[model samples]
Target: MTVAVGAPFRTVRELWPIAWPVILSGLVALFINGNDAFLLVGSSDKVLASAVAASAVQFVAAMVVTGLVGSSQVLISRAIGSGRRDRAARRADAGLWLGMWGGTGAGVLLVFAGPVLLWLLSGPAIDGDFARAYLTVTVAALPFVGLGSALRARLAGLAQARGLLFASIAAAAVDVAVAVVLNHMIGPFGVAIGTVAGSIANALVLAWFAVRRLPAPTGVRAPRATAVFGVSRGDLRDLLALGWPEAILYGASSGAAVVVAWLLSDGPAADLAASRILELTTSSIAWIVLTGIGTAATTLLGRSLGGGDLPAFRRILRHTLIVTLSVAAGIVVLGLLLYIPILGLFAPSSVREASVPVVWLAFAQVPLMALHVPVTAAVRAMKDTRTPMIASLIAEYAVFLPLGWVLTRVIVLGLTGVFIAHVVFWVVSVLIVGIRLIGRIRTPHTLV
Candidate 1:
């Protein structure tokens, strides 16, 4: 199903069919991260604090794994777009291999390093022991999570995202059921166990679909076969070159959030809880939409680039920006109208009250995020990750963190200040990427 990017309205209509399934899949993925907090919502403040802290730490690790394998989607999409089914299959296999081995190494390192890291990050308020316990269970399942990412990427790159939707639904069902059973059987630890179980289920289901979709390996073998598991040395190098920037980008962004949470740990308990609630809610909505749009952009732009269709690429980019910005505007309006009730659903009255202003502040940045997310994905689809990574570094480290520190700590602006700093980060990121994208568009012939 090749996309017709010539007509803007037709392109958008075509986009929705592809985007909705990926969006649903992203939502289900969020369930894996959010169910813990959802189940623990009305628990004691201490337990809620512990769960939030542990979850945040766990999220950073998960992002690292996902980022490391993210290039599979871009490479597979480009390969398929260029009509190289064999190469696409090989790249998929390489991603799976990397996920399995990389996950093992990461899990092992986390087992040893998690405690101290959690201790340092959790500060005096949060329960370090509980955080460490959660990390142990979830980290052990990193391989499964990593494998799931690779499979999902392969399917998405092939424009077979419906498979991911089914996998996500099944996995979410398992996650909720396991979380309930474990929560009753043990305690907060059940949430972590449930998360691991769900991740494994998700990976297994997606793997089944991915295997069926990918091409079978040819029997031909070179005189000296250097490839392992259908992936050559050059494949590994390409994956790394394309993937590391993404890893660093995800790590930096997540790390900044963790730092903000830690800084808030010294404040009131309500402040910390509210911050967590706000983060989860906003991220769930924003990321779901962003990921969906990004996937579409990646697939469409990748195919255009692969086919050397510069005009089509430009058309798709323009249409994507329009659709994504419209979506962002809608999210902003909906968030403003519904944030209070939504906050009430996940947080106690005290926490909700404390979080209202922060939620409003976050909503203000959605437009900038809407612009940044799809643009970044478009840039990545061109197989140029370094640009987005550099933009992220400057936005997070150079602008966001220092500003957040001064506002939250030095000037004592608190949560409000932290959120404002976040808005500033997005603004700068959008400017940098937007300018680069404009420059590329003007010279579309040179993009390839």
Candidate 2:
């Protein structure tokens, strides 16, 4: 199903097929991550804190893997768009090898360094042992996380969104079942184990689907010696060149969240719990949509650039901004309407009450986030990742963190201060990226 290069509206219509599956898959993935928090709700507050803290560390590590996988998507999409299927296949294969090795290194590091990291972030309030135990299982599963991310990127680059949906649903089902059964049998630690199992299942299913869908390698090379395990020097260089900025982007953002969590450690228990629930609810919803829209932008714009259809690329960018903003506005309204009830479902009364203002403040940032997603995605699809990375770094470190600290600590605005800083950061991000995107679109610089 080749997209029409001329008809922008028709391209928007075509996006639904791609976008819906990606959205559903992303939501399911969120569910898989949030399952532990959800299932551990009725447990003690310390247990819940431990679970959230453990998951936070794991989330940062997973984002690092995602940074690497995102580069594979860009390369694969462009290769296929330029009618270089063999190149796409090789890139995908290289991505898989990178994932395996990267995950192994991450897993080993987490096993050794995770406890100290959790200790610093969680402090003395949460159960350090419980957090460490959960972190150990989840971090050890990084290999599977890496593999799944690479496979999903390959499928997404091929425009096979349905495959990702299938893999995500299967993983979510496994996560739910294991979390429920194991939590009953083994307490909170069971949730972490379930997550690990789900990661492995997700990776295996996606790997099988990717193998079936991706083009077979050319020539008579042995399966073992062929693209299945092939890793070239050029592939490594390209991946790193495109991927390192993304790693910094994700790592910095997650690191900021860790800082916030650590700051909240000295506050009330309800505030800590509220922050987690807010993450699980409002933030999760926004990220799911953003991720889906960003994936679509990458695939469509990468293809357009590969075909040398600058007009189509620009049109795609415009359509993505319109559709994503429209969707984000709708989500913002819905979140506002359902804010109390949504928090009510997952959190106790004290936590829910404390979280309401934070959720509302977060909702206010949605439109700005909507504006930022497509612009950054367009830049990254052009293989100019550094611009967005720099923009994000400035927003996170320069604007958000310091402002949040001043508001929360200096002025004593509590959670509201942190979320206010959140809104300001998005505002800054939108302006910086918007300016860069406008310059790129107008000046007609060559995409690297």
Candidate 3:
């Protein structure tokens, strides 16, 4: 994929070049993640629950790790769009620095605070030996999670999709191989070990590309390994300015999800496992597909705004919406078609019956799930991170949490109630950001 040189995307096909790699990369990682269910075939309900729960927590925490990647996306894309290659490289270095520090800090917290957080979020139901064992081993992946994500954001800004895809493939290979070997000997903890090994492999390769293999946009001298930690104060401020809102929003969202889990945990654990299965399975697929479109939107939007072309930015938004809606329909249809197989793969017999409808119910979220990614990307692309953050806060605290509490607690619907609340959350959250997005995308071709 070529970085935009102040020119707007001229056709829909242009997006495929930027979109496919990240989508493929996410799928590779997720496949290994989903394989956990396959690997533990004869496991008990609690073992199955612990496997999914610990993994879910790890995944959410990882998203929080990379959530601020928008900083690099906005900064380097703008610099590249403006033909300021040296500036783009410097901004990327700052992002790398931030990622390392943030990820390291997060890891420490997961180790020290994770148990407490677990107790608070899930109570007695989930505070068992297997879950704790999985988390303790998997926590080592924290730094790699951050470091790899930062390197990826930098590559994305430079439009180096192939590099990103290759790194993901490498990580997936190591993760799967390690998990397969270890699982035969150690069971559930093998998945945890695989995550750490794969993360380290992923980080190493991405670092190789960032420092040596990938060519920086010419104005900077080739970046050195040590340059990542040499970020200036100004660069830090710039990253934080565009990054914090989305970061905080993700953090809040993860917390909100855990509370929903707590509600489900209060009931039968099969119900909880069913909920987690739907989330890690269908929800993950939806996010990966939609996020491909969002990443494309971010790239196109950042370039158009950086080059001061308002009409082009709006055009990109229009194209993004068209693509998202079309893809959303396919996701729903595919989810319907695969419903039986998915339940077979991830749900134990205990969870299987409950999950039958939960799988169908999840499709209620596909449309809005698809829509929100690009809409939020559009808003964030204009560097208006705070508005989306505010919009999300309202969507969650004001609507999602209340609705979920009613459906699961007051109404006593259990797993089904949680899914219903999820559907409504996406609906409300999408609307708030979408209304704001409509106004911004209509302005003349320029940065908001």
Output the number of the lDDT-best candidate.
2
Comparing candidate 2 with candidate 3, which one achieves the higher TM-score?
2
Q: Each model's TM-score, in the order given?
A: 0.93, 0.94, 0.92
- Give lDDT for model 3: 0.76
Candidate 3: worst 10 consecutive residues by lDDT? 1-10
| Candidate 3 Cα RMSD after full superposition onto the native fold (Å) | 3.7
lDDT of 3 by residue, 269-312 (tens): 67766776677678778888788778867887888788887877
Count of backbone collisions in candidate 1:
0
Quick one: how many clashes does candidate 2 have? 0
lDDT of 1 at 7: 74
Which sequence of candidate numbers ranks them by lDDT, best first? Answer: 2, 1, 3
Residue pairs with clashing backbones, model 1? none
Cα RMSD for candidates in order: 3.6, 3.2, 3.7
> What would the per-residue lDDT of candidate 2 be over residues 1-448, giving only the tens digit for each residue?
3455546567677677777889999999988988987898887767787788888888888888778766888998888778887677777777787777777788898888889998887664577888888888888678888888888888778777787888999999998898899989988877888898899889878876765543443221111225435588798788889888987888777766676777677677667667777876886689788768788788988998888889878888888888888888898999989889856765788787887667778788788878888998898888988887888899988988889889887898888988888889889888988888888787776653
Q: Of models 1 and 3, which has the larger lDDT?
A: 1
How well is each residue in 55-78 modelled by candidate 1, as lDDT tens digits? 777677777878888878899888
Model 3 misplaced regions, further than 4 Å: 1-10, 123-127, 216-222, 442-446
Q: Which residue runs of candidate 2 sit more than 4 Å off their true CA positions?
A: 1-8, 213-230
Best by TM-score: 2
Give residue 218's lDDT in candidate 2 (0 to 100): 22
